[model samples]
Target: MAIVEVIVPQLGEGLQEVRVTRFLKQPGDRVERDEHIYEMETDKANVEVESPYAGVIVEWLAKEGDILPIGAPIARMEVEGVVEAASPVSHAPQSAPTPSAPAAPPREPVGVGARLELIIPPRTRAYARQKGISEEELRRIPAASGNKLMPEDIDAYLAGRSETAATAEYVDYPLPQQQRAFIYRIKRSSQLVVPAVLRRPARWDAVRRVVEQFKSTPNAPVHPSEFQVFAYCAAQATLQHPKFRSQLVGEDTLRQYPHVNLGIAVARPGDELVTALVKNASALDFVSFVRTLQSQIRKARAGEDQADASIQLLLTYMGGYQMVDAIPVLVAPAVAILFAGEAFPVEGVPHVNLVLTFDHRLINGVGGAEFLNAVAQNLENAETLVQSGMAG
Candidate 1:
């Protein structure tokens, strides 16, 4: 029979190799074409590989956690086209080979003078090797001798070398204890890869009207408060500036979703962070959006089944807290994030500072600024949202 080889599929940019996380089929097992065969773990996400042809599994060339080169043969399957010729009817008698005893296990290296194997943290090992420092060399470093290689050890090593020589050996320090994980990723990824561009001012008048209507509603289960109004305004703004509602899928590819999914950042118990999504924000009116947002928040806080949000825009209300302003990161796959800061009364006029951070790859500085302006313009005229309807 013809043996077919299976290989990992190309995932995306900056992806070199993927870890084999799971295998759905084993050697000698029959599999169908297009059936899931295995999963690979990439930096972007886990991807499943499918069998290309219906065949009997012959061998698996790779194991789990094995980092295979691109296009490397991972498995072999025997096709049905060819078969070995065999004698018919009468069978020939054969003698089997005697089984041998298993070989002794290899012994570990002995003596204190033996070379020490340094286990550097992930993302740092590659840098260490590039500097012509082997794990043994790292272990020999005075600072690294008594303890595991920390940031300080790496820093000290680079400090002694020429600036140009150690330029690429840097590693980002861990964030502060009180920092939010999302915030950290956003800031770091943005600084390294993305450019922050602000859009024009959006009208806030329409948003103001909606908030007033919610406040006037009697016995409203969903609080028609200022924060809820701001959320609705942001969603409606997305409906208008559809580009801001799109996500940067690739270097030049921008993917726009048909529905506007809104993510609301909520502080969970024990200072943990979670985002509650309001699906189809454009379809729902002010009150409906608030109710859905509140319900999702409750579910998230209760540790219920909250699904991943394919959100076009993330709205974080720091107004409830004391934060005045923040530049939030564009959560990958999401194109933009809107931050609504605390609202304060200035000379009898209530005004809130709003910031919309967008992926510059998809939306330019002028476009981002304009989108923010559009949101602001709507909020300024909040009457339209309230007059439209309330939560059912």
Candidate 2:
């Protein structure tokens, strides 16, 4: 048996550190090699990291929310292999070894080695880089006001200047948990996904016909939003185009689904961006898809839980906005997302700007355009189901 160290691997470009957000396993638990054991949140993503060696966990050096640098060891394991020295343990502050010995207070002049992941704003980081001021230097200087050192703090540190209340304003608030998850996913989307956005004008005449029918019939139960209709079409298209239903699981690996989990964007209270899920959307008929989607929307508006992480395609509505096109951020695990704006007329023809954002690594512009054209063609010919009341 050998003792091995599992350390934090390099996360991504320009990233130096990550926070240990959650631990899936603890000391004494048997972990298989390549088993995910911890959730690490970098500046741009929150991802589960796998254990390198199959063995019982010996120690977990970092606790939840502890900021750790790349190559920092967070755990140790006993494996059946030739012994390899464990990665160096993180230098983050820990509790005292004995209760009788109180932990030493934090030191002034926080070391450069431990300050790589300091929380500084974009402007501050740029100014620090421009001024050749290290983040460690910021922590070394006594804060004139805020706990975090800022660009003005840098000036105060180097030039022997001071900032006043009149010239500086600071505000701090913790993000809501749901919002934080949304942000984490968005950052992953931006950093990891190679996005391709396609824009075209589509007229949802078939959708309007169905919505119009809903108005005439008293208590016409299913209120199918135009987005649902578009989603239904896109879902059907995914059944034909396997690429739209695929998710990038590795550098060159794609895991495609037999059916699509259609994700509908709904506005929730507290600035939370929730994607209400329609599970196995590709298997549903028009009416079932419509009712399920509308129900999800209603449940979401009532502050109910409907969103999940198993999204395959996203449908978002941005009505009453004037723009050339709106490109959606392709959420991770979902290769494609659709955006729709208000329908307007051009030369007596109704046209709605349809935008499709896809992961370029999994798909390309030609495939994306073909997919949108499929949705547009379905929307144009929606009268078959529209006249049938979409009851199927």
Candidate 3:
């Protein structure tokens, strides 16, 4: 048996480092060659990395949430092989030999290698790039901690610069990274899409019965609610209406996804709002859907999954509250949002108002009304949506 080092591989496109999001395999667990061992969050996407050698896990050098550069050893594993001495991994891009030419004058006083002395995370660099901050500008900003620059430090520098540039007549306050990101999304949505709201009455008597039935089940993996049932129905409805799963890519292109990625808006303590995502909801069974939704909600409240743009639709529930109907803000990239309000007895029949805020650019008022009707119809037949195998 030979012990081999598992290092973070080169994730291309100029990315230098990645943050570990999850560990697929733990120590002492056997893993196969080319099997995914861990998942990492890059600036671009969350990627699952595959192992190069089949081995039994040894020890992890990094933990969840740790940011490490490419070529950094992340774990060690025991494998059957005569291990040879491995050379040190280089992070710098390898280049082919070229003819020597006249050297160009340096644009900045500090070289790129000198800038590397300070440990700036890849996420921080992405944020800086979005703000049009140059390397020289980054050099001028002071790190909050020992040699490492954080996103918060960048926010402080930008706030200070904005305050300094403002006239004495007005005062400026610096928002946290999370709040600023939320505001940016709101602004971007308003600028990009033409939004419109459509509301319809959905009979909740059937949905309520389904919730009660689940409550009687012993040891249910997820507790079912009217809101969850509605979300499930909405996700399933997208199978017929493809526009609900569509997103505006460029100015003129409409891209429809094959599966439904549902976003549930969760309000945590201190009035912080986050969206918990259930990726590929339409593909999962009813029980699986509810379980995944419950898990994602817990993660969102714990500050794990924030508002993910990949979600095709968003659902905000105000059930049990006195509110009847609300016009939700249509979050961009997602063309449709559903708002479920308090259910009330109308003519001896319990009904809830479902307001759908949709992008008018992608869906017309007629299409929105038809799609919502389908969701309402789905709720009316809640027993079929929540199958008998839920307790199994």
| 1-392: candidate 1 lDDT, tens digit per residue | 55555556555544445556678898779988789889875555557877766788776655554455456556667766532221111122534545785656865533321222343443454455556454334445555665457656766776765555557576443222223234433443454346574533234344555555546879755556677777777788777788866765547676786668887777766666667778888778665677887788788677442324266777777766887667776665567788877666666566777777777777877788777887787687676555564533
Question: Which regions of candidate 1 fall more than 4 Å away from where they truly are?
Answer: 1-41, 49-193, 197-216, 219-221, 304-309, 389-392
- lDDT by residue (tens digit), candidate 2, 1-392: 64555678775656666767789998789988789999987654468988767789876655565556688767666667443343434334655588787777854542212322333445665676566444334346665565555778778765653334335576323454355456656765777788889999887777787667676788776667666666776787787788877777668777888988888888877657776888888888777887888887787777554544467788888775565467787877688889888788888777788899998888988999988998888788776645443555
The estimated TM-scores of all candidates read: 0.55, 0.60, 0.60
- Candidate 2 lands at a TM-score of 0.60
TM-score of 1: 0.55
lDDT sort, best first? 3, 2, 1
Name the better of 1 and 3 by lDDT: 3
Candidate 2 local Cα displacement, residue 126, angstroms:
38
Candidate 3, residues 1-392, lDDT tens digits: the string is 75666778876656666667689999899999889999986554578988767879876766565556677767777777544333234435867546676666755432212213455665786688678565435656899888889889999998888877685676543333344345656765776779999888989999888888879879866677778888888898898899998887666888888988898888867677778999988888888998889889899888764566577899999987788889999878789999989999999989999999999989999899999999999889888866733533
Runs of candidate 3 with Cα error greater than 4 angstroms are 1-174, 219-221, 388-392
Best by lDDT: 3
Error of 3 at 102 (Å): 25
